[model samples]
Target: MMDVEVIENSNKCARCNYCRVCPIYTVEGWESASPRGKLYTIKSLVNGEIDVDARVVKELFKCTTCGSCEVICQVEIPLINLWENFRAHLNSKGYILPVHKKLREKTFREWNPYGESREKRADWFKDLKNLTSTNSDLLYFAGCTASYRTLSIARDTVELFNKTGLDFNYAGVDEYCCGSPFLRTGQRDLAQKLFLKNYKKWKEMGIRRIVTSCAGCYRTIAKDYPKIAEKLDYDFDFEVLHTVQILDEIVDEIDFEDVDVKATYHDPCHLGRHMGVYEEPRRVIEKMGIELIEMEKNRENAFCCGAGGGVKSQFKELALAIGELRVKEALNTNADYLISCCPFCKLHISQSLNNFDKNINVLDIVEVVIRTLNK
Candidate 1:
């Protein structure tokens, strides 16, 4: 018995185009870019209707894999999984994009998608209290983006834990890629290798729980990790959580001072649609006593930051183009700041904010905690 949701929906697709929800399609507007078109193309390929080519690979990889298409899909397709499955399928047929090929090599070689030195992974902690060990029950898995790219979020997250009297540990440089970048890009073989390595590390250290400020990390380790682990004949028993989920637990204990800006929250597609973590970040924001305005799309209906699915790395311009739309939605709220729980979202949307000449600040929930931590 196969998982029907996983196996049959692609063929069940009614070609209704109800899944016009694709972000890439929203920007590219090509029939090949839309989910409906992808399904047709995919169906044809499976039935020997067409030949695989560089062009098809390019269109298939155009997606952000945001799961929006999955939400509105008329046939209840497990669209995210479908896209990824097809991506892996494409890879099997030697359709690997150069960018994806480079990313896979860089991640495997450098232990991160950034191609940054593994030693510098802990550089963010040099200025702060760096906690790295498995002695503590909680391990802060900063993921590559937060640990290297968005250093402030990593620092501020530790600061928030301090302010709220939450005790945890950080993996620092010992942290490897969560394999999200590879997984999203259809490099499941590499993803599985990294996943097994990290799981073995946590198991050896007796880590009881893991928390992360990166939504991609949260989804990968919390949800995808266990799934992949079972495939590896390995079991990862540690509890996984997002920093916001931990903050939500200690939210009332921590004090917050309101700043001058009205803030709107952006839900990371991985955290919101991928994992269904809609309210914890919201609750953390509301508890700050700041004026929280809703974005045009919020919760389950939230738009993708265009940074997921390896889009930011491969299609930089397109990623920014899609991100600009989300930034526009945030700006329309007249909010001075755009807040999100995921560092990847922070990195992408923050770039868009600057690109649009909008003076709006992009903040992670941890930074907000640092601001109001009885200072």
Candidate 2:
């Protein structure tokens, strides 16, 4: 059965074409790839006007779910949630993509979508000094990407926290994936299991505040978890935050050496449009005395890094294409570095730059901040 809310929301597309601002639609150019086209297709499927086929499956899963369409939609439709719910519906009907199927299997079996060992989840920080025990008011969740794919982000974040004298804790091997991958890829059941696992662990540890270096984890825990908590009748008592929010609170207090550089900030979609975190990262960068340049599209209008919503894993070529466009925007500013708060964004944007013979440095804001302090 089709979701009633999905049906109602699909019926709400105004056909204003404002959602052409969608990054994927701009690249794919097929009307079927457009936000409106997806909505119409969804409505037809929901109303039994059409049947699911290969073309329908491909078009539906093509979106990165960046929430750009939601930002531009004149009818105020919540396109991001709509797409996820529609995908969930599809998943229930066994229409899961092959890569997404592997993603689900890995996440459920290994506690992360990357199929990485849970034991090595904390290996990124193994070499860092002054590690804390599992007990503290604060927890540093180095989501799957930072712990495995972007080791420097996790290390730099820990180093910054140590340098700044912030009392925090690390979950070590016990730190499960925050389930952003599951949520974005329509594995709500898997998401719930991970959420419950993390939530129970936090509660048992008496954790009052949680900080994550990854934007996807921050959004999943801060924004998505409470909804799950309410549904499951869990207490959900912890305060969740991204590292930039913590940096923003403390940036004014930190004294830094002079590091002259021109940089541009890329707002991760989970950090920016999905969660309204636009200025804190920029403010932190500017506070460091770096000349912060703005991209042609920024803040709520920032283009996606194309790594989210399972696109990079499932549709590699399309993801890189979208990512290349964002890298071009960063390069157009002629900046020395491209900065972002999300490790996933940093990882994808770095890979995207490899497509060009000329490349720029891509660092997480936390990495830049740590370097400035160490200098």
Candidate 3:
């Protein structure tokens, strides 16, 4: 978000209706929730046609910020950037969402968005002997979700790295937040502070390459961190690779046995569209010799898992609604395992599966590999 007005970007919306790919708009079917409608709202604000109000702010925050609209925009508007700017503007104008405000407070106090204690951040990997160390070729950054919620993914990923004989350091409790949550919520200033903290911590460890299991961390650290770094007067240029990318590189050494499960891969919005990493995760799945079922929406045109852009926390009903739609799509493929790369996506989609009373299992792509590794 720059010091300029949202009009600069909002004016670029051509109203071509190409942004119908937005999952929120697809389910809600409200023009105010569509990407095109949001841009018009911003323009209205700029032209003094409307004042900042809770209703307007609520409509703005309904967006998932999955970057789908920006991908298909006919006029090439920076819709993601514009939406973030609009949020920031609203925040400055005291039209902040109450849930987002509390989330910001929790992130600042707990150093994690879930309001969980930072002391237990690395408790996920405490059982692995000699797995946590420094002065290695790379640092395995177990993001907050992986470290706290998806413990198995973190453990399996570290085990996979060791099996492949990669020299990587694990930044356990010391690993600061990658600021993905805050950035998605337009708390860029707080995000920059975390960015500086993480960068300085990594610099002290002399870390060269960084690998993360979570897709949001991948997008935040790899894509947004650089821009945040420049804004905060910090200089850093280290390589950040998602675990899928690293696994794709070492696929030759890892032996995955055939599994009897029919799995459909869910493209996490940040990893696939935000980072352009559609092939690597799929390559890992294909190499395992399992049948890959195609979802009606996959890759760039893929539907969002409804977890991005703080929607999962604030708009619970809308989030679950979109996730259920995705789960129904996966169930349509008759896939036993609904595999996705990001832990957040797994969490949301898995919850939605419970609502449908379906027997589908939502597993991370890496988790799927870990199950079949050496079997």
Which of the two candidates, 2 or 3, achieves a greater lDDT against the reference? Answer: 2
lDDT order, best first, reads 2, 3, 1
| Distance from true location, Cα of 37 in model 1, Å | 0.6
Residue 153 miss distance in model 1 (angstroms): 0.4
C-alpha lDDT (0 to 100) for residue 155 of candidate 3: 87
Candidate 2 residue lDDT tens string, 1-375: 878899998888889998998888888897889999999898887778999997799789888879999998999998899999988888888888889889888877788889999888887778777754445689888899998999999888888887788888887887888988778878899999999888888777778999999989999999999999999998787888999999999998898988889999999999899899998988999999999999999999999888899899999999999999999999999999999999899999999999797768999998888788845
User: Candidate 1 lDDT, tens digit per residue, 121-222?
Assistant: 888887775543336778888888888788889888777666566777766677899999878777888988898778777776678999888988998898
Candidate 3 per-residue lDDT, tens place, 1-375, comes to 334646677776778898988998999998888888888887897788998677888888997889899889888877787888777767666666788888788878888888888888978788888654546969998888888788888888877776667778876677888888777877878888898888888888888889988999999999998887787677767899998898888887878776777888999988988889999878888888878898999999899989889898899999999998998899999988888888888888888888776578889877888788875
Model 3: clashing residue pairs? none
Question: What is the TM-score of each predicted model, taking all chains together?
Answer: 0.95, 0.98, 0.96
Q: Indicate whether candidate 1 or candidate 2 has the larger lDDT.
A: 2
Each prediction's Cα lDDT score? 0.83, 0.88, 0.84
Instruction: Look at candidate 1 and give me any clashing residue pairs.
Output: none
**Model 3 weakest lDDT span, ten residues long:** 1-10
